[model samples]
Target chain A: MIGWTRRNAGDQSNSEAVIQLTNVDYTYQAGSPFAATALHDINIRIRKGTLVGIAGGTGSGKSTLLQLLNGLLLPTGGAVKVLDHTLLPNMQKPRLNALRRRIGLSFQFPEQHLFEDTVEKDLMFGPMNFGSSRKEAQSKAVEALKSMGLDEALLKRHPLTLSGGQMRKVAIASVLAAGPEIVMLDEPTATLDSAARRELIALLARLCREEGRTILMVTHRIEELMEVADEWIVMHEGRAVFQGDADELADRSEELDHWGVAVPEQLRCWAEWTARLPQLAALPLPRTAEDMARRIEEAVHGFEKCESTNIASKEGSQQESAQELNDQADSSMDAPYRHEKEVSACVTS
Target chain B: MRDKLIIGRMIPTGSRVHGLDPRSKITAMLLFTAALILSNGWPQLAALTILSILVLTATKIPAKTYLRALRPLRWLMLFVFLFQLIAGAGNGTVNLAAADPLLWSGTWGPFTLTSAVLSSALLAVSRMALLIVFTAMLTFTTTPSMLSRGVEGMLKPLSRKGTGAERFSLMMRLALRFIPALLEEAQTILKAQAARGADYEEMKLKEKARLLLSLLVPVTVGAFRRAEELTTSLEARGYRIGAPRTAYRQLIWRSADTWFTLLFALLPVGALLMRLTV
Candidate 1:
């Protein structure tokens, strides 16, 4: 076990862990009638400036883990250290307030928290509470709204008047106004249309890439985060079952699917194709459509050499088999070509 | 139908009353209730009534909305008025002497209205109305969470005695939030029962009582399940009962709160002096 731990610790010098859960165990009130253990002996570390995706089924304790990051819930049996604050079962009031200011949490279906009359006041609530002046808070609200790709005209409008997608953005902008170093969201894209979901993911990606903020989001849809997330954490029945880089996750796609999380269909198809062509399997698995296209081009070139070898070895029977293999390749190429063209259009236009 | 409840509806006006620290509002409410109790005559009651109405108007919520809020109490108000009119007692009546020319007209019954009973009933109804309107004003402007926090803040000075005030308020807020959701669930259960040969509206009184009792079992079981899930979610978010934490929305006392307090305080004292002089 020690050797495996040492072997796994490779090239972690550039990144620093922002949240560390050390042997954390939590059980609901023990003497109560409905008492049950929610999490047990959990240890995980989330690094700074990375988008970490946590995937789990219902009642798998994914929600329980997110609460521990901001000291919203305490561990019953162990310790949780978030940044500079160490949270024990008994925490002082002052320390808890300090911890909350450093971490911004957006609860599930966050639009419920929009209780202010106008978008500006709702966004300003957090910053003002944390001791920002009126002017500074208003500026932060504007900045946060802009980050969500919302218009300045929305500031005076009631939050309830906005459309569903806009309401979700304003809810997020309220959290951003607090200016926390780390932002955690619970199912941010749940119930959104595909276009809105894509825009939200892109916005989160920018926060991590451009603003240098650490983001930890819980998502049942693992495929949604495939292109943007740098790290993957899989939870099952209150345990951190797997934690590693995105590439490491690609190899464990089958295990993930069995755990009730759907891996992207594109990745699965590419994996199956690579399995039949052993020479192509040597290359790294691609995370996006463009990456898949480049890999396929290389694979087709490799296939030409194999075809030539087969023709040289068996000149008599090569024509019929070669034609059939070519036909299969042609069909596969056609679908991917159209997909690439659509993606490029989206990117450019 | 469930959405019509005035308890958790937060009107997002940024008026001074809306922004005043919840602790101040709670204190002011107690003080206002005490003054209403001390008020005796028309002069004092009129002052208190006018003050409440002015505050209500200043909230800038629609007049129609305020009247609509009173709709729930309409039946109860009529009951009180009818009870007062019929059941009231008065002084003894005097019969006229027909032979004496100097004798005037006689009072036939003791049922005639008198200052004592009439004044008491009128004052009681006015006090009740004032209390409801003022309390509604507080809830109308503030979120349920803020109200709970305000209650917690007011109780903070005594928290050393293990009251768990903050946790209790948090529970109240959660309960208020889930009331509508629970009512919807109960309605669905009622509909399901009706679909399966249980006609609640057509049933006799005894049968209706039995059917309602049967509905309680499922509703209670559903409520417990929800409470369990809510507890887990809250606990996971680092909520500790009895642990002190800084408020996200701090209540600060402004000049308006102080001025409002002074104005209410002077009314009862001035009324007492006026009654003594008269």
Candidate 2:
């Protein structure tokens, strides 16, 4: 328990690299007839305590990259450094189970791996394996499940009997019970509905913001992750083509469509918003719907303030102009992606 | 490791054997099995070996594949050979012309050893090897779905005895379909556990046992879940037990089928004659 807790204390160092990869090359089934190089000369640097979203299309080597993060697959060339452990290609890997215990990887469709009948045993499994006492493991399991927003009463029930979403959460909770500092998830919200996806994202954000666990979530649903991810890493054909903060991402997001990732809808809406109304263009880019609404609220407030000043100057001719201005603002803000007339009119309105 | 196995694998080649009706292939396999069981001595064994080699060569698949099928069972074959050699040595006969000549007399801790048993052991090992190779040939030639359909057609007559033969074939088809799916799933589970600090390659026996328990339960659950979904889909498609149905891809029998099956048809009769007279 002490090692598990203290092991991640290094991950809390904000500026240092939690994961550093240098010229890594991975070929699946190397030396076999089917040997195909999945990754070649991949170099990446993930800073400590950042919730980073990894975006890519299918067969872009996103899952293969996650496997390399925790030494599940050794590099065929170059080096990988995570925390204090450094993995060199073709070198006899020094005991890596210690490194694994500190980095909890929640794979895609993880619930399908839950073999234990009872949820309690499944959650406690990781902790127990890493040498926690039964009592200590039980507490850790409870703590992990609670953090995942699961009811503690469900711990004694069979994991198989749980709903698909619940089983997925419990499967992740089982990994978290080991209490690794760096958590990497591969498309964690892949199969969930929109609302469930939001909840899962919020939970992951909480793990980063409050719990101080660095997360690298690989996903195809880039728009969903756009709101919460502190930064993004875009991969294309087994290469990290882009890595930057959300503002830089929004700036370069138009080109993401060429790489097979749709420009997140919010970014599209923001582009339309800024291109028409040049006044608020300098403001920080908003990713979520709420963020967009807040930005629009500012625009509306600015218009109202300007309208009030105009109304004071032209007192007798004010009422009719105010009504028209309100109509113009509503039409422009509502259909943000619509024609240029409403977008340009709203700024003057 | 499982991927290296060549058993129950179909190699696609439009050869004389591969293009035959699956029922003809199935019949040939049955006849071959009977011949293997009834053949008693050297001449019949030689006929079976020649027949196996000819049928295998007709498939155009590499001979190495048939050998690869036997690779996994090599250890078991050796153990069986040793057991046979030990058990037959109690006859109290010795043939020690050459050095050793598979002969060693006197009690060595457990039992007595003599000479003549080595001949019998070689025969038994050869018979076992032939049986495995012949079965491997049948699997290599026929695709699983076609094989299942052939078995269903062959077993159709048993439905008259109320033994539910088509159900057995259906069960077999389902099993054949799911084996690869299950293997893939089990691999994923193994990786998931490894990511959670269950070091399978380095764990002690007790820890390995625990890892197996973790693997087995999820796989069982996944199977049931898959079965439930399959049942629903089948029912939705109007599948019914013991209902009238027509073949979508009807089996076409040709002269080449009869020509191939005729060779196998002679062996079983020849074997029965040998069994009775020899």
Candidate 3:
């Protein structure tokens, strides 16, 4: 029953706050001479079932923020609320094992932590720690493995023997086996091939969408999560400078560089398109290349139609020429798959 | 854990001690150790302690930093003190009726206490404290590479060829450099495992052992991976074993370094002189 939260009809304000940090300041080795403030005055509220991408440069307190949420580290100042528990500066932490079970944190290069003799055992370690029976843990292990899009046969192999990608997946699956409501991964896609990274992100997005688990992921590269991240938290030098959806992120794309964050190509392309055609901003920001391309084509077609109408009114004799130009525009329409290259060109231009 | 380790760390105050040639510092450390071992009486101990304090003051680092370095060894120091005290008190082989008479003798409960036993114990504890503080000073003043280079320089005469000394010094340098890196990696792994609910502090002894067992593979693998990367980098930079390499920053033995070594040489000589007079 620990870490369990039941919905109350009367309470609505903080009900959606799966993880909330209010004026949270974290200093490593606080009170010691070597004390360093890793995070400063950070305030972020992540709602339930939302896939939040936490992006920051190196040492921007992204990893520290994840640790704070899980009670691995108590803040030197302010409070960190994850699920039903609240962690204050010097409070006797609520049963951390219980809190950790509810909020699974997978650190950067998590594959390096995989140490069990076999992959199944490694996956079971988390569930067993949370008081699950051996059989229950085994079943959970299989479920977790399957959820990560890994083969069931891989459960019997030694974790060290697995391919790097497989090992990374198994390592992530171990945390998933604990059945945490809030799964926080720190740079899960790092050191992974592009295809593998995409697959992993898709799987994580599915976990958030299908299971309604709040997924807080930390990444230096925001491009990987641009499509799926329901919310984006941009950390700038230990501060949560921005926390909003894709559109809001698009609006503030200019500031990403000042924050030491590389503005994703998608965001840059969107900014360019929005700049050229101001009315395109009215619609929801396209999350995928195909969607963006389609939107762009539609906008271009609308512009052409307006141009042709104007020409027909002013110069009725050149109506055929306008029709010919419209046909040419239709033929010149590039396929959606080529949008990424075209967008990059547009951004560069 | 990383913060606890003061050895292999250099806190530069830009003082004379920091500027002293590492070779002279290493020589001074050996001389101090010899003096510390030779000193048996109160006067000798007091002299050494004062000398150490003076040298420590010259370093310009906070006194508390050295005390913090000693923090981890508190229990060991206590254990040594008690062991020496009990052994000295219980020794029946001591000729108490001879030259030195007991300053005081008493009994409380079942255990006997004597001034001779107490003094000897205090001496042993003081020696240990001084030794630790002095060793810490050498490390604190000299960077790991400089220490290794000084060691290599000293070992040059003993080697049949330069290769043996060069290889050993390189090994020393690598170890000094990597100890902190390895500790940091271990800490990270420990934190990662803790996040998975294997909180080492909360775990029982058996569970703790099991968790440590689990950590061994990853840490070892990480070390090997790092070693491989390091070798590749070294080779990439055209470094070769036993190759005649010139120092980028050559060790300059100033008149100050000679004077520094000579000052340390006096400690053991003074201790020996005092012993002869007694």
Candidate 4:
């Protein structure tokens, strides 16, 4: 249910760094009347085969940063090196094209790009562009569609006729059709219903975990990505405000709002819990609902055992009502959990 | 590419031109165009040019902003100039049989050019440049809502003919409003193509055309979706084309607006006066 797992079956890409940026700067419409600098002196290294979440407010250069990852946007300053290809200011187009083929980029609402008559043609479009044979491209399309949890029968139907959720999946599948090593998506879950959002997240997770692909997603809401992401990059006012793991991100939750990003709900709730229950302050951060609930269960169990010891030595009257209270609490807390997070404080304790 | 589009975009300078009634601006624009057409010779053009400068100064917007509005029309203006030069139109003396003793003659595969052609080209370019500047001033000063309202106000007389002027104006408004949004989507799709290894910069002429044509479906799809949403929103808000409605922001014409209107009214009248006499 969680994201990161080292792939051993095949295609275990051993590269330490998949994408690198050195002193990168980008300015929109440079040397024009309305030229505006989007990024400056930006340095970033995205680890291979990890789900990296890029968070920023609107116009925070998150999208600009995505363009520079491949050669979609040549850096106005410095260089962007993707794999063995270095995107210098005067880099050749053939080299850039080669580099871009290794990284798949999906714009927000990529479904809007599905222009072919049928889903099959749309899926085959990318692979065919990369010089795949018709037969190979056809097979790749089917495989991509299947990987995205879409029915193979959808290949014949017009993409516009599909339901919104299905269309979104197909759009993502088309990006995957080309078989790129890294997939960078901009606001992938935007406008999706909560269920669809979760499904998309799961599909992206599967891409990273199962297929061993590197994913860099640009999303304003951090909660959904925080769960699956191995690393987080926060952008504010054209610069990296913070770049770290989830724990560090959680620590920065209080200041995130000032920087114009939503603080993760779990982090906010966890903050309240720590403020109320100071004894549990030393506990590790929870990534999911189950993790938090399990931690609470442990804390309650600890408090109960202490109560039992006091009760055994002194009185029995208070024990019955407290036990009744415990039972009521347990009954109320009993609900089906996704069991997403593997780390549980209760087990470790 | 989008940075150059200033037609639908309004720069809020809080100037007197911006504060004027939309009706007044619309009237002035009509008068200006009539004056431009009526005024033919150098003296009339010089008078109109001076009048334009006066109006331009009154607006207080930077000259560069006005020039930016002409940026998109540069190629069109050039084409018009070239067409006037080659097609032997305007100023009878521009013909091959001409009078003023050719300053320079050059052959380019088929056609010959002379001083008469150059003079006529100058005339066309000047006229075009003036029209672009004046038109740009109107959009730069007025916001899109005012523009839509101004158009509707101009079309008020045709309402009796049952041509659905309101609906037509609304359509125009929507088109103007979505230009930037559509451009943004286009930029995004291009980025997506690059990610797919389309290599837009390195693409051949045929490849680029194919890529653009491929996006036509999604762009149309997106437009339809937006139109649907807009319909729902309008319906929800009780919007009807022919319904009687109170003015949300009433257009009020002040004495200053009248004065501006009167000042611009001089263009056509003065041009006629110049044509009759000088």
Q: TM-scores of all models?
A: 0.51, 0.79, 0.90, 0.84
lDDT of each residue in A174-272, candidate 3, tens digit only: 999999999999999999998899889989988987898989999988878877887899998899999988889988899999999999877777777
Find the candidate with the highest DockQ and give its number. 3
Task: Mark the 10 consecutive residues where model 4 chain A has the least summed lDDT.
Answer: A331-340
Per-residue error at B275 for model 1, in Å? 46
Residue A240 alpha-carbon offset, candidate 2, angstroms:
5.3
Which wins on DockQ, candidate 3 or candidate 4? 3
- The docking category that best describes candidate 4 is medium
Q: Give Cα distance to truth, residue A208, candidate 2, Å.
A: 2.0
Against the reference, the lDDT scores of all candidates come to 0.70, 0.79, 0.83, 0.77
Q: What is the docking quality class of candidate 2? A: acceptable
Best candidate (score: TM-score): 3
Q: How much does each candidate deviate from the true structure in C-alpha RMSD?
A: 24.3, 6.6, 5.8, 5.9
Better of 2 and 3 by TM-score: 3
DockQ of each: 0.02, 0.47, 0.73, 0.50
**In candidate 2, residue B265 scores what lDDT?**
96
Q: For all the models shown, what interface RMSD does each have?
A: 21.5, 2.1, 1.3, 2.2
Which sections of candidate 1 miss by over 4 Å? A1-13, A92-94, A309-349, B1-278
Candidate 2 lDDT over B8-55, as tens digits, reads: 878777788888899899898888888887775567889899978888
